[model samples]
Target: MARKLTPAERLATAEKDLLLEEIADQSSWDQFLVEQAVFHFGQRHDEWSCNDLRDVLPELGHGFLGAAINSLRGAGIIAHTGRTVPSTQASTHGHRIGVWRITGKGRAIAAQRRIARARGRAA
Candidate 1:
């Protein structure tokens, strides 16, 4: 058995999800490109957060980096470093975001991708 959401809570959830989708769509880069950019970014740094990633990525609207980061996290490509830093965006008002690092599995996969990419180029 589960408690149902109140009408107000449901509406808030819908609105928040809508805003998230809108921000994700606003990016000039598509979802795969966004994911790829962040994935490769992890290879170059030991630990990073959206604040650092923002410097490398293109204009992604508000909080647009989250979906891509979450995707990688879900796939076990990265893991939280058990650290956090205040978000630079004024909208977040200094709230914290997790710092993350690539895992061994992630590094192995990245290496495979690099080899495949180089082979593709050589062909």
Candidate 2:
């Protein structure tokens, strides 16, 4: 079983997430989320819906998430896996929502961005 987070650790994580969101630009934040989603959703075996992502990234505004989803879809970075899952949002309790998975192209782009970020920090 996974260890539970201590209160202090949870607080620190929340602070860090907030600070990162504030510092990052929209595109950068979106890209970061795309990479994060790969891990968050279990890659190819699992998929995430909008609400799922929202739950994981509460710091991101709805408008930002919507735009990011569209942009990634357009760029072929993410695609609907032709699957639908029950909505997790309270407002849409019974509705089915689209499921998305990262594409190979998306993974490639994410990898490149991750490398660039690492290099930037190193420099």
Candidate 3:
């Protein structure tokens, strides 16, 4: 008689199948990276300042990071606490000293992307 698989074995097999499905669903790398960044920032949502984000992604030069931040804000993925400050170069500085906090939608998207990546790895 054939023996049935153990509970652990069955779970592992199911997990592997689920992972494959997730990998197949991912569209591109940019989507993956954005999801990752959002997720990373979401973890420390309360402490994430624009400077903190820049530090986390040092490769994203200031201009690029600024654009990304704007994009996130526009997409409603992040929001500011509504505080502002004047800079040394008040004439040229229009940006505020805002702290970024990820929205619930952002967190959910990030979590979905992470799950997809994890599933891909399992596959």
Best by lDDT: 1
Cα lDDT of model 1 by residue, 1-123, tens digit: 446433223222312224456546543346545666677788899999989888777785334578777867877778999999999977889999999998887777766666766766798
Off by over 4 Å in 1: 1-29, 61-63, 121-123
Q: RMSD of each candidate?
A: 11.3, 12.1, 12.2
Counted clashes in each candidate structure = 0, 0, 1
The digit string of per-residue lDDT tens for model 2 on 75-109 reads 56678899888877777766987888877766665
Q: Give the number of the best model, judged by TM-score.
A: 1
Q: After superposing candidate 3 on the true structure, give the runs of residues whose Cα lies further than 4 Å from its correct spot.
A: 1-39, 84-95
Question: What is the C-alpha local distance difference test score of each model?
Answer: 0.69, 0.59, 0.53
Q: Write the per-residue lDDT of candidate 3 for residues 93-118, one digit (tens) a residue.
A: 65656666777766665566568678
TM-score of each predicted structure versus truth: 0.70, 0.56, 0.53
